[model samples]
Target: METSRKPVLYSYFRSSCSWRVRIALALKGVAYDQAPVNLVKDGGQQLSSEFQSVNPMQQVPALKIDGITLSQSLAIIEYLEETRPDPRILPQDPKKRAQVRMISDHIASGIQPLQNLAVLQQMGEKKMEWAQRCISRGFKALEQTLQETAGRYCVGDEVSMADLCLVPQVYNAERYKVDLAPYPTIRRINKALLELEEFKTSHPSRQPDTPPELKA
Candidate 1:
């Protein structure tokens, strides 16, 4: 049960940032070890000193690989993109790559940060309403962005980092009761992405740490 050949990933089933990295690793055919950090237990395992040593930010997706630890979902992904160039996650064209990053940033920074667990926990009773409004506004902008940049996937027919980022945000939106009916392009792309083996396997429901009651 103990093997160090594969890189170790510190993750949580429901953390969308962790989900992004999971999807990327599966898509690239990289073998990794999953070390689940239960975010809701003991007020959050991520906040513990042990995990903080791995990621000062105490985030769920702290990857330990290449003899070092890396944190921040996007940064860990970019490192993978750089080191493992085959089956690329980014496009060859500079403009297209920029477009992909633009949409990715829109979700990662614009939407995700606003509705994260800490923020929602702070909002308490108002969290549901606040998160719904935040998701609606962000999705409105994202739908417009996708209308221009998407073609089957967020950037083009090929799956990019944008699509990886998109699916989990949409999942989070659903959790907050944010309707997806208005975002036709997002829904279309998400449906297609869900069908992929990589995306399907990387879903929260399929993760090892998913509770028996929650697993698909």
Candidate 2:
């Protein structure tokens, strides 16, 4: 079901979820086009009817590829892993693979969602405080888990889906001004990951739609 047509990613420059997909695409060395969906502009372009048709969830990281459109960052990445296995993101070992999924879920489901833009919008004046609290709590647990599973990357020295989830969540934490001092393992891994070419190029600051003032 492969096609010569390049995949198109619908993304927002500063979106953590979209950034995860960007990292996966870069790591896989898959060339793609971007359809920028300015989440802040025009009262949120993701809410538009046209974009909703692309992803009913109205998410910024919807991927149009292989004659189909896929929503949800992890699912899209898994699809890529299945179709393009070399330079794999998931570990081949069963236990290590389970650990990778566990860490990825810990951040993606347990942490990231709690601080998502829509969730923060609903918190009104309490948004910043709430986001900080959520990230701090999640990072506390993640740090403990990473101490056991991490080896050069999130799972046994190979860059896995967990690493993809970690970098963006850390970005969100910094945006919310959550202190990173307590999460030393997380900070250490993030620093190492940031030095990689794939992570650097996929970073929000370098995105095509990143605001001029925010570009790195």
Candidate 3:
């Protein structure tokens, strides 16, 4: 919990889920080591024996701290919140917190799970058009919701967990070649989020695993 030691994060540069955790860690001012797990190289380095020991699920964005390891970005973020409350990302009011969580879930549950790289790969093996259609549909719903709730940030002026969720999903949508112009809300929030130092630094292009050409 203390900032004295650095936490180890198993992450990939291009992974939106890992980028979410990276952004949260940076926002919390939590020092961490970027243990790059090249998702595309070496037949998916996350599945390697060495990495699997850290995460049996062989997933990127795992965390190791004080001999305790954790899986899943959202869960890891909640742990960080519980252990370190300063500069809180969630709202103090229960209703506001629920709203924040709702927006986070809108992306986490509603969109991310469907368009994850692995899932998209599986879909590609079946049909690429189907993959694009599903991702577009999810984005359409997200665009509508963000238009209704967005202010300076996703839910308001303060950077809640929702902003963290929104930024990376937008990046993923772009990667899938999804036209973002239709989602004016998403484009607006994405522009604002990109201006922040934390979000800018935690961007996938800024990570070590990101290709030189992709770096912004």
Candidate 4:
């Protein structure tokens, strides 16, 4: 549990889930090394026996830290928040913390999974339509919720786990061509979050694995 070595993150360039953890690590000032996992190359390097040993689920954004390996983006983030409590990502107030969790789950569980790579791959020619529909529906609900909870960030003024979740989901929405015109609050908050150095550094376009054409 105690070591001098930096954490190792297994990530894919364009994965929203990986981007979330990347943001968390950046915000926490955790200088970790990345092990790029090409989710597309060679029929998904995540499915390879080597990466599968790192995570049986073959998911991106797995973290090796504190003498153990952890998978699932939210789980990895919570571990970081718990272990490194400086500049906290969760709110101190109980109700506000619940709201952050609600918003995070709203995107992470209710939205992103429906439009992820695996699901889209199964949809074939209909993938674009499917991703847009899912994102639009989720954003509709999220915009309403943000109207109540948002100030400068997703919850009040301070950045929380919800902000981390929101930015990447918004990026995915844009990639799928979901119109942001209907969701002013979502667009405004996403814009603010993107301006932050942590979010910028953690962006998929800026990652080590990002292709030359995709670099930003």
For all candidates in order, the CA lDDT equals 0.92, 0.93, 0.82, 0.93
Question: What does candidate 1's lDDT look like per residue over 120-186, in tens digits?
Answer: 9999899999999999999999999889988989998999999999999999998888988999999
- Estimate the Cα RMSD of every predicted model relative to the unseen true structure: 2.4, 1.0, 1.8, 1.0
- Model 3 has an lDDT value of 0.82
lDDT of 4 by residue, 1-216 (tens): 356789999999899999999999999899899999998899999999999999998999899998899999988999999999888999999999999999999999999999988899999999999999999999999999999999999999999999999999998998999988999999899999888999998999998889999999
TM-score for candidate 2, please give it: 0.98
Q: Model 3, stretches more than 4 Å misplaced?
A: 1-4, 125-128
**Model 1 worst lDDT window (10 residues):** 1-10
What does candidate 3's lDDT look like per residue over 1-216, in tens digits?
Answer: 445467899898888889888888888888889899998888989888999888999987898875789998888888888887778888888877887788888888887887766776777565456556766887788777767677888777788888888899888777767777777887888898899999989988888778899997
Return the clash pairs for model 1, or none: none
Clashing pairs in 4: none
| TM-score per candidate, chains pooled | 0.97, 0.98, 0.92, 0.98
- lDDT per residue, candidate 2, 1-216, as tens digits? 468799999998899999999999999989999999999889999999999999999987999999899999999999999998879999999999999999989998999999988899999999999999999999999999989998988887989999999999999899889999999899999999999999999999998899899999
lDDT of residue 177 for candidate 4: 92
For all candidates, the clash counts are 0, 0, 0, 0
Question: Measured by C-alpha RMSD in angstroms, how accurate is candidate 2?
Answer: 1.0
